[model samples]
Target: MYAATRIKNRQRVCRTLVAALLMSAGAGAASAQDQPTISMAINQSPWLDSFVAMVDQYEEETGNRVELDVTPFGGLLEKIRNSVRASQGSYDIVNVNSLWLSEIYSGGFLAPLGEIEANYQLPEGVLSYGNTTNWDASAATFSSDGALMGVPVNGNVQVLYYNTEIYEQFGLKPPKTWDDLFANAKAIQEGGEYYGFVPRAARDSIVYNFTPYLFSHDAAFFRITGPDQAEVTLNSPEGLKALETYVKIATEAGPPGPGNIAQGELIQLMATGKGAQAIAVIAAWGQLEDPNASRVVGKINAALLPAGPDGMIASSAGHWVAGIPKNVAPEKQKAALAFLDWFAQKERQVDYVRAGGVPVRGDITGADLGDEAAFRFIEAYSQNARHAVMGLPFASAAEASDAMALSFNRAVIGELTQVQALNQAAADLAGVLERAGFTVSKLPDL
Candidate 1:
């Protein structure tokens, strides 16, 4: 009954919204075309609760109409793609994940913010993802010379999360390397108290979860050779070693059916006190301390992800970005610009974190939210963001990542040996890059 009433209320709200828009078109000195009425497309994510409330506040404060279209993470890409292709302005603003940045921007479907605001500059304290949002067509890579296409919506990067109580019980220190992690996780799992690890090995996101391991082991999916050129390098000795450790830890210390684990499941494992540790995005920190959402609140502590073979941490930058769609009409573009203009305000950065969204500006990352515990992970988050690597940033990033993800999932599921998966993935990635017009070659398979 409540669900039905809520749906009806939503319908009524939509009707009222449309009516208000019509009335404003005739009443305001600013033309209806110049009004900041827009539909923003975003994925339903862990941070949606805070973001929605913030959007409501924006509407209430400015009296501008905004239609937020939420979609599942998987379908968001296609929705943005189809909307851009239609060229009818179904959405004025679109969410762009770091992985999708190259693909969407390189295709010329999104307009640069500079084109909308000639005097534009990213707000102070905005965290940098050097050139990831800026695409250089001539070089076929993110470069300083590229068009500045998007702004950081949230700063998210993988961080090592662990149960401090579990570590205390085990008399263990934090894991700093792959071998250290493996040994510690094995010990915890054998203690029979809780899972020692829970990686996000789901096929849809395995590449993201696996990136730190690959980089730490000194392996890469593709090595940039020159402008518009790369070589598939995943089948190298380092990658083989990385995969071996990844599979070994997931199977020996992680919950069964490891290949099916994603962010939600990983969070549940830790939140319910069933798991001891995992490397997960810092955005998860928001819900970890809420009494209703977590039983182990305040028991969780974060650190840098385990260092690689080279003794360097290599967490992947997974920040979501916001940009305008080029296919939209000029009026819609201006409407989108107004929203971004509001977004660029520094005061809103603090409000964003308090409302559960991660802020991109480093200066305000540690802003007080009345609850000291709310941003306890800010130190680790900021450190990780500073060193985060851009994962598979290129026009064919999706295709390449998909191919790699499939092989990684199969390996985790025991459907294929790690080496077989790596070789298959490398070959598949090579083909993907070659077809995308990148001059691709292959490193000798291990």
Candidate 2:
């Protein structure tokens, strides 16, 4: 509710600012065709706040104006989808989560940035504009057949967070392996005073939290063996074992009403020292880092994510990218690129970092943040990326994620055995994908 409210209030403020800008410029009724006014829509993120500040700086220098539209995270996707489908050009540049890049590019809704990048002289010490973590900033998400949509804005990582006081009191070392994690969780929960672990089991949290385990077990959502053979791969032995591990820790170490625990509550429980450990997004640690937000500030420590039999720590990347709209005027597109180039400067990136954005470039690490816990999170996240998975379409992702949540809830409640739950989940998921027109032959036959 707080995040939603913040998003609403932020939108109100942005609208007021844009209205004021329009009034000062003495323009009325959408002013003459392609007269240099640009519109941008972004979800409420601190990184975007910094980006807006950069936009202001760019405007002052170039005399180019930008009208920003801000919305809540929940509302942003729907808005983008509706607007892009109409080709109404509602947004000149849109800020979106990295996961949605494929869908946006594939839909042919976004404009190419290749020509624009070639024309602009980016600020010093910045990667070329439109760079995302998925391809090292050199490659674009689209094939030669499509436009280069979405410029990468911020980079976020996932890490394992633990309660320092709890570990110390129980004489438990940070878990290095899944076996150690299970043993430690059981030992810590034996006292029955508090829960030892909490896995995100509600809605989307399930997939965000579960993907790493699958990766650690050396499984993937689809076999990228070939474009023609991409298929579902969630039922293999390793995949089933990964799901089993989730059932073991969540059912055994979590609270009885496990399905009711939302991401915020889980984080709060960990921050208030109730949970012994959890795998959390890097930005989540900022809550513990804040003196007013965390009661146990110094009593928290971050560790690298644990390994499974494969010895690889799986993680997800949360990032934002800016892309142009299809059929947009070349001059307007050039202006967007100029603005983006300025926004990617090192100094501006530092500003974004200070405002809570994890840097996308590899140069910023533990040394960059200067906070021990934050540094630890960076170290863990950087190492874990070796096993990171790419994101799929937003709606498909939400559906796929919900399937895992339902299975997890059932397993945690003992309504189904782990294998039974995973098998059922695999079957249901295969049906869902088939309906969505995906093939199931090349993926692991779980």
Q: Largest lDDT belongs to which candidate?
A: 1
Indicate the residue-level lDDT of 141 in model 1: 76
Model 1 misplacement above 4 A: 1-35, 60-63, 329-332, 413-416
- Give the TM-score (vs. native) of candidate 1: 0.84
Backbone clashes, candidate 1? 0
Taking the tens digit of each residue's C-alpha lDDT, what string does model 1 give over 163-273? 999999999998889899888899999999899888899998899899989888887777778887888888999889889989999998979999999888999888999
lDDT by residue (tens digit), candidate 2, 352-378? 565455554444566555553544555
Error of 1 at 228 (Å): 3.4
Q: What C-alpha lDDT do the candidate models reach, one value each?
A: 0.77, 0.63
Residue pairs with backbone overlap in model 1: none
Instruction: Tell me the number of clashing residue pairs for each predicted model.
Output: 0, 4
RMSD in angstroms between candidate 1 and the native structure over all alpha carbons? 5.9
- TM-scores for all predictions: 0.84, 0.79
